[model samples]
Target: MLYAIAAVILSYLLGSVSFSIMAAKLVKGIDIRQHGSGNAGATNTLRVLGKGPGIIVFLLDIGKGIAAVLLGAALSGQSDWVPVLCGLAAIVGHNWPIWYRFKGGKGVATTVGVMATLAFIPALIAGIITILVIAITRYVSLGSLVFAVLTPIILVIMEASLPILLVSLILGIFSFIRHRTNIVKLWQGQENKLGAKKGQ
Candidate 1:
C-alpha cells in the first residue's frame, strides 16, 4: 500500500514537469501559456514556436506518461491497479500541475502515453483511427476526443481488465471536460485547424 501511494505521488511529480514550458523558455524566453492558445501543450507549442521545439516537447511529454506508468509497475510489484492509478495521477498532474500553479495543458499527449502503456493494442488501434481523423479533418481536438471515447470501447471488446476499462472511462471524461471549449468552437465552426495561425 505504501509503495502504491508513493508511486502515485512520484508519478504526479514527474508529470508536473512541463516540457512545453521548459522548451519555450529555453528557446524563446517566453511563458508558453501566454502565447498562442494559452495552452501549455505540444500543439500550442508548435503554433507559438515551430515544428522543432513542438515535436521535441510532444515526444518528451509522451515520455513522461510512459515513465510514470513504468515507475508504478516497478514500485508496486504485482499490483494491477497501481500502474493504472499512477497513470491517472500523471494525467492529472499534467492537467493541473502542482509545479505550474495548477494551470497546465489538456493532457491529451499524456493520456496517449498512459493508455499506450496500459493497453498497447487498444491504444494502437484507437491511435491509428485518431490519426486518420486528424488528417482528414485537420481537427486535433476532435481526434483527441475520438481517441478518448474509442479507447474504452476497444478495451471492452478485447475483454480488458476492469481497472483498465475504468481508467479509460475516467480518461474519456477528463478529455471531454478539458476539451469543452474546443467542442463549443467546433460546433460553432470557429475552431482552429491543425496548421492555422493565431486568430485565423
Candidate 2:
C-alpha cells in the first residue's frame, strides 16, 4: 500500500511537468499559456509554435501518461486497480498541475496515453472515431470530448473491469468540465478549428 501511494504521488509529479510549457520556453522564450488560446496544450502549441514543437509536446505528454501507468504496475504488486488509479492521477495532475500554479492543459493527450495503455482495442476504436470527428469538423476540442465520452462506453461494452470503467467515466467528466468554455464556444459557433489562426 505504501508503494502504491508513492507511485501515485510520483505519477502526479510526472504529469505536472508540462511539456508544452517547457517546449514553449525552450523554443520561443514565452509562456505558452499567455498566447494562442491561453492553453498550455499541444493544440495551442500547434497554433503558437507550429507543427514540430506541437508534435513534440504531444508525444512527451503522452509519454508521461505511459510512464505513470508503468510506474503503478511496477509498484502495485497484486492490486490491478493501482495502475488505473495512477493513470487517473496523472490526468488530474495534467489538468491541475502543482508545478504550474494549478494552471495546466486539458487532459486529452494524456487520456490518449492512459486509455490506450489500459484497454487497447476499446481505446483504439474511440481514437479512430475521435480522429474522424477532428478530420471532418476540424474541431480538436470536440474530438477530445468525443474521445473522453466514448471510451468508457466502449470499455463497458468490452466488459472491462469495474475500476477501469469507473476511472474512464471520471475522466470523461473531467474532460467535459475542463472543456466547459470550449463547449460554450462550440455552441455559439465561435470555437477555433484546427488550422485556424490564433485569433480567428
Root-mean-square deviation of every model: 1.2, 1.1
Model 1 error, position 105 (Å): 0.2
lDDT of each: 0.93, 0.91
Residue-level lDDT tens digits of model 1 in 1-200: 89899999999998899988999899999998988888999999999899998899889889989999999999888899999999999999999999999999999999999999999999999999999999999999999999999999999999999999999999999999999999999999999999998511
lDDT by residue (1-200, candidate 2, tens digit) is 99999999999999898999999999999999999888888899988999999899899888888889999999999898999989999998898999999999998899899888888899999999999999999999999999998999999889999888998999999999989999999999999999987621
Error in Å for residue 58 of model 1: 0.9
Look at candidate 2 and tell me the lDDT of residue 106: 94
Off by over 4 Å in 1: none
